[model samples]
Target: MQQGSSAHAIVVLARGRARVERSLLSSDVLPLGYRGAGDMAGESALVGMESYTENVIAMEDCDVVRVPTSTATALLRDDPALMQALVSTVLQRQAEAEERLTSLLFRPVEGRVVEFLLQAMSRWGVPDARGTVISAPITHLEIAKAIGSTRETVTVTLGVLRREGLLATAGRKLIVVDRDALAMRK
Candidate 1:
């Protein structure tokens, strides 16, 4: 959906990938995070907000379930445990956003890209004979947006990592060849 548009319901991703991004005045968008299967978006609706704080665009074909605001409110009202879980989720997301802001403020682009890759691996990577493989064919532009850098920078950093034998690619997937070495970079 468009940024700043009112959301009447929470869209839960049942499958596939989507990016949550914020538009800057310059017309550039910074990706806040990626939501895969089972992740929820438009959470502001649950709290009675009129609009979504970020724009959510599907990165691939996805299946989603829409829970209307009224239904979500009713569910929270009736179930204390659910409400507590929702509160916990919100707090966790807030903490993550804070950490991202800190990284953007202090870290170099290379460091940010490495950190983003590591986080992606932790969240979605599957162990293989080669290394930890992130199955998604994430584009350089997507990486750039996530790390607050340019696509050219991401491409160069990735090229450097590849030449250093710290990362590899097999078909569409990305493999971290040397996780320890990658992590050692500040």
Candidate 2:
């Protein structure tokens, strides 16, 4: 769902992950965060929103179950767990937004990119002898969206990061060469 159009249903991400974001008028993507399997999205409809608040782009192949707003609202009323889950999801999203805004105000593009990579590492990173490998597949454009930058800028910044020995890429994955050094980059 895009920013303005409400998806009048609850999206149960049953498989894979999705990038949650808002498409800016300038074509810059203000990414909120990610939604993984078992996470529920598009709950704004049940919360009295006129439309879906954010655009959810699949990070990979995904399978989803959509529950109509009316049904989901009824379930929300009868199911305390569901309500709690929704509240938690909303709160987490809010926190991510706040963090992004803070980064935008105080950090440069490189810092933002580094921070993004570090955060991703903590989320889906796999431990290996070389360093922590971010298992999730991400594209340069997605990185730009998350950091509110252009893809070309991201590409160049990544190159600089690599040259500095702070990061590396294998296949479609990003490997943090030195977590401590990379974290100190900002």
Candidate 1 residue-wise lDDT, 1-186, digit = tens: 667898799988999988888898998877778899988899988777898888999988999999999998999899999899889988988999998999999999999999988988988888988889987768888898887888999999999999999999997678998899999974
Which candidate number maximizes TM-score?
A: 1
Query: Cα lDDT of all candidates, in order?
Result: 0.88, 0.88
* Model 2: residue 49 alpha-carbon error in angstroms: 2.6
TM-score per model over all chains: 0.93, 0.86
Indicate the TM-score of model 1. Answer: 0.93
Give RMSD (Å) of candidate 1 vs. truth.
Answer: 1.5
Where in model 1 is the C-alpha error above 4 Å?
none
**Native RMSD of candidate 2 (Å):** 2.1
lDDT of 2 by residue, 69-114 (tens): 9999899899999789888978887898899899989999999999
